[model samples]
Target: MKISPSELISVLAQFNPWWRGGHIAGLPAWKRAAWHELNQWVTQPPVHRAVLLSGARQVGKTTLLLQCIEDLLQQGVPAANILYVTFDHPMLKLGGIDAVLAAWREREPRAEGIEYLFLDEAQFIRDWGTWVKHQIDFVKDRRIVFTGSATPLLEADQESGVGRWHAIRITTLSFYEYLHIKQLALPELPPLRSLRHLFDWTAPDFYRVTELAAPYTGHFHEYLVRGGFPQTAQIESVAQAQRLLREDIIDKVLKRDMTALFGVRRILDLEHTFLYLCMHDGGLLDMTDLCSNLQVKRPTAQHFIELLEATHLIYRLPPFGYGKDVLRARYKVYLADAAISSAVLLKGKNILDDPTALGVATETAVFRHLFARYYAQQVRFTYWRGKQEREVDVVAEVGGQIVPFEVKYRTQHTGVRELKGLMELCQQKNISRGYVVTKALDDFGLLAGTPEGINIMRLPAPLLCYWMGEAELHGVVE
Candidate 1:
């Protein structure tokens, strides 16, 4: 059942409606925060490398590609010169990339100038990395951009694609991006260059910022439960949104992509492991206990975890320390989005009523923001555990400086005793500043009567996420 060139051209025509003199429809009016970087790379690449836009399923990678096509069209690029095709489509999969290209060249022989190829879900193509490398090395006046749902696109061909392509990860929406996607109206605050910039602010300045951020506080719990997927951001019903997330994001990755890409045979075992991680999200992982409980071997459980991470369903954080200390530590596990936990567990809006669940979800959200903000800067995120079981939730290593953050998202007053881990880490590391994310807006300020030299800011979780998201959008860093 081979697809002919004509049949492939028919499919391509359907995908690329602009070739028929129709506009690219269904484009989102508001672009993602990643759009700026991606657009720049596509239009004016710093290097002559192709762009690989990678992320989990349903994070709007396809939409971003379509938006890029629209931008190219607006710039007076001939519609036929811009090709858009997805290997996910069965027809395209049958024909492969070669057939599609052959058909395009045959049909558009007279077309000239730069050609843009937008390939979606490119991992389905066999030896895609080598194909792209050949194109980059041999082809001229051709700019290629591809999207992948899994990291195999990266892991499988790192050596070959070392300098041939630039990878840009499109994570689940940040709180600020989520708010914009939801079209919520709120007051505009002054730009924040970095989280560290807040430490230098006076009491009046901090309060004024917090007051301006008051409207965002009400949406924090919602964002945590709904997660950051653009599709679910505007869904009014919590149950419906979680249902979509579970079916679209979790189920597809576990059932289909794992089997197709990674040759995973025991989907039930993978599902069980993911559920266990959801229950213990933001907690340290014990593979022994997990294997014993799931009645699986150590290697099998380890394989499942790796496959999950590859699919971008989970993130593993190693403990922060030097040499053997880091190697000997058990890693902490977190779902890419807090809403994944909520969706898988069917926690819905009730998650807010459960304080323990609320705390774990908040910590997951905080880590997501931190990872999104600093991943490009080569920041290493790890947790710290000390004697008597004192642990800082997240310890970020930026340029050899240790910045510790602890989450205290409880309604009660946060006393100095509660910030023991952050304070201890700051003192031991001689770190001048740290942050304790709290639940109340009134908790926003500097900790008083401290250890003199060390300073800790008690910021609300909403404000922290919002500001971090905003700062990342603006490419603001210290």
Candidate 2:
């Protein structure tokens, strides 16, 4: 039911606790990276575009927007000039984005300052992109920032927000960020140049690198199980975290987001496919096999997979190839969060205690960290599967430079022979260097091939994963 403007203002007052002459009580600390970006966008010279913030549900999109509001208030911006509206609120939903803005204008028609519009869960407003475009086109003084759950907004922004929005994706925390969030102490890390040299077999930094990362090895196992969701990472109990993940992340995405956005009928089939995909995390997926196993038609199976991917619940990694040919190759499916798989399949059990499970979870974790590395960048990351069932976990290509990486988490598989897939791909692509991510083997050396062949390098998994998120990816502080 539609509520009056007075009720709407009351709701706004509740969400913006700072408007009540005090700071927001119990506001969780915001991520440094997100805070920095918002600060840059706000304090800089006025730009003509709105900043589109997108991520999976419960990844702290709302919290980040609230923190931005707090930041603006602290920076001498009037509280009245900052408008924070949650589109998903039932009362707000009844009036839509335009009506909410109109109400705010009516409340203070003569307010004379540069206004900030923070629209949270903006996908709930129908045709939000068109409304935002209209606002920015006609009312150029206002700075508009909107957050989406990543299902509809991604598509909407592409259609209506072209060249008018700066998109920022707030993914789950990286292992480095996870450490600081959990208050865990890590030893001093080596320099970024030394870490990058680990990818070169001829470099002499392998021993020092292992020594630097030794203290954080055990925490990697925890990161894999806990995954990177902000709230789940904060929970101390594994079982409790898993339960919350299953309910807040998994079930909600499937039942609420998928249905509302995709008009999905027979949700059980879609859910079953998701569960199956989680069980086979990081494994090659054959559509024919999946269709038969799920007892659904090919079209239905394809639709379900597409919907899952669009909602950011899972990611499909295809084989490296050019253009349309890449679509023909079989792809591997990975849960967006490692904990989604661990929560469903292992029931919050510590993966470190189980060797086989640990290996699989490690591969999933590697894919996630790599995904975060290139999420907003122009790089394309894929998996390489060769004949004889050989495979590499991640193959990244940027500006025609192909870097193949293999994740071999088993203690026994850190030898040169285990990186056959990466080496073969590197040779075929004419790339000189490759990396092998291992459990603990930190030594790197040139693996001499037959006459007329090139040498490849192997690096430790812990160091590579940490470096990928920390320095190599440009998101972490060195």
Candidate 3:
């Protein structure tokens, strides 16, 4: 059945509402939650030659891209001027970039500044970079934005989009966006702790604002135990939610993504390894132990972990290499998102036994929130494990200087001495600040340093998460 180009256009024309896009895209409406980022992308003209958006399964990449298309159309671009295609749809893959343009040719050739092509699940297209480049060669004035869950991770064909893509890695909603989904106003994060020490300085209005958020604690707990995947928030039954998280997101990543992208064959073993990592998501992982438990060779475990990482399912920390004393095999492992761990490892009251698991989930959520804000700038963040045994939960570059952070679930505490070794490393590197973020305190409780001007500020965790969402990781640098 050789299809003519006109036939192809007609087939695509049936999905024409998708071409109307945004409100017209005949799917779920764009979640109001993602407006901030979409607005940022929309308001700013394309800086990179093309924008590449990535995220976990069904994180609204298509809807967001459609809204982005609406923004383009509103800017005076006409419908025929734009090409829309599903480069990859898990259910039935169709319409690669070239095929999209080919179908469009049946209608008419692109008129200047009129044609914009959006390729959803772009990585599925064979030689996609070449296809788009071919378009760019002829249509010198054009726009091409791609949407995919698995970030191509700097691996694109040389034919078209080299040094051209500004990567926008979409993620599950942060607490900030979640609030927006509920139409709540929590634009700023409060002080870290609710300590009485700061009460004397607070005004009555401040207390009222703090009181307004009392309900969030319950939802926040639910978010921690169940996970932060968007659909997880919609499902009323926690059990059903967890099932979707495991079957749909987790397995989809392992089976479809890992195998399709990385050629992974021992997928069951990889699933087992992932379960092991989820159960031990926050523990200090020694890679050799993983090999022993999974009954695989050490290198096999390492390779599996690398694949897990490449697909954005797992994250590993280097033993903060400041001293010659740390073991190469002792880096800690964290699942990329807390919900992934919560989807599998958390059940009923069992989550409370290791209540710190909530903190782990929160930390992973925070890391992901912050990671997206910094990833494009080449900021490498990892954990710190000093030779002398002190540790920090997260580390990142601030104004080209490294900063150490410690995350705590403590409700009535101020602690940072534990990150002493990491702070020393910060001082050695002339880093700006050492921070201990927690839930208990409303104000930053300064930690006394080792008399060498090694500053430690026990600050609020929610503030950091909020700031990251606004792309303000650079805001608190010093």
Candidate 4:
């Protein structure tokens, strides 16, 4: 059902009320820190590229776009010159981005002024990459920002992007952001050199660090169940949060977004695969078992997994290998947020009391932190599995240096033997230090070996995740 031009004009008027000599709507005050970077790109002098903000569903990409527009309005960008359109609007499908903008221009023909155009849910537009690229080439003195759900648009834009598009990914809230949202007060954490080596308890100041971070034990527990999606973060009741998570996050992605975006026909198969994933959130992906469990063909199982990743509902981390086919190795799959797992599996009951779920959920929280923080960088996040089934949860490889992180969610002393995977990987890679994220213990010291060996650092997971969210790791990784 194509909409008439007058209908689009009416919708455009509603979207850009400021165009009619009225006040711009005030943006939400609870801004994500990612907005700071967007402001930098907007205010920078040589703003050539279209700023692209991409993230999973409900991670506040649309809110971030509105915040950016609000900032522009506050900075004296002419309201009439700015255009904000959500591509998913039914009327928007009648005419594409170019047509709507053309109609807006026809309504108010004013040249010699810079315009800021924001297109939300840009993936809905057909041939969006080419259209965006063309806009960059033809539109002069115009700053454009696009927010999308799918990631393939990234690859397409990269091919034609050249100096025309800069991408910034927005993930669910980090642990620190969660804290900020909850308004929790915390004691100062012991200073660290960089995020990569933040848990380096090999340092002599380990005792002081442990004492400082021990107070937030309960908060970390809540974080695992609540997770970091801004919408569900504030809901006090567990069941209520789970309901919203199912209806808002899971159902939307599985029912509407996947079908609309990827043309997924067997939604039941996709739902089954996702349920299996939720049950085994931070575990290895065994397609043989998954196929048998879901009663789907191998290709169907693989298709479901790929589609899940495309919609940003899950993450698939490959095993670490040197100069070999890493893709062929077994992969560890996890829900995009810890709360998703809790909502689907635990029904929003706090997992900290349950040892089994707590361990996996803790690792899920750690992965979310690293993912939200370092995904834009040139870091390869993989897991390490050695002989005798010794494994490290996360192995971050940057510039030929390997940092193995083991998640042992116990609040006691973990012996050297328990760190077999971390020790072996450090020895194999000739690295010095490794970390174990613990539930509460902050024990940090070295395990001396014949001649020399890697230092074993035990740090609190909550503090580490919080610090990671607060700082940038790109400079340290380089």
TM-score of each: 0.98, 0.92, 0.82, 0.92
Worst 10 residues of 2 by lDDT: 193-202
Better of 2 and 4 by lDDT: 4
| lDDT (tens digit, per residue) of candidate 2 on 355-397 | 8778887787777777776655677888877778777788888
Query: lDDT values of the candidates?
Result: 0.88, 0.74, 0.64, 0.78
Descending-TM-score candidate ranking:
1, 4, 2, 3
Error of 3 at 181 (Å): 1.0
User: Tens-digit lDDT track for model 1 on 1-478?
Assistant: 8888888888888888888799877778988878888999989888788898888998889999999999999999988799998999999988999999999877666377799999999999989878888989888689999998547886778777888988888889999999888888898877778777788888899789878888877798999988899888888988889999999888999999998888888999999999999889999999999999999999999889988887788899999887987887799998899898878988798889999999999999999999999888899999998767889999999997888999999998677899777777887889898889999888888888679898888989998898889887777767
Q: How much lDDT does candidate 2 score?
A: 0.74
297: Cα error in model 4, Å: 0.9
Give me the runs in candidate 2 sitting further than 4 Å from their true place: 30-32, 45-47, 108-110, 156-158, 193-195, 199-204, 441-455, 472-478
Clashes of each: 0, 0, 9, 0
RMSD of 3: 4.7
Error of 1 at 441 (Å): 0.3
Could you tell me the lDDT of residue 144 within candidate 2? 82
* Top TM-score model: 1
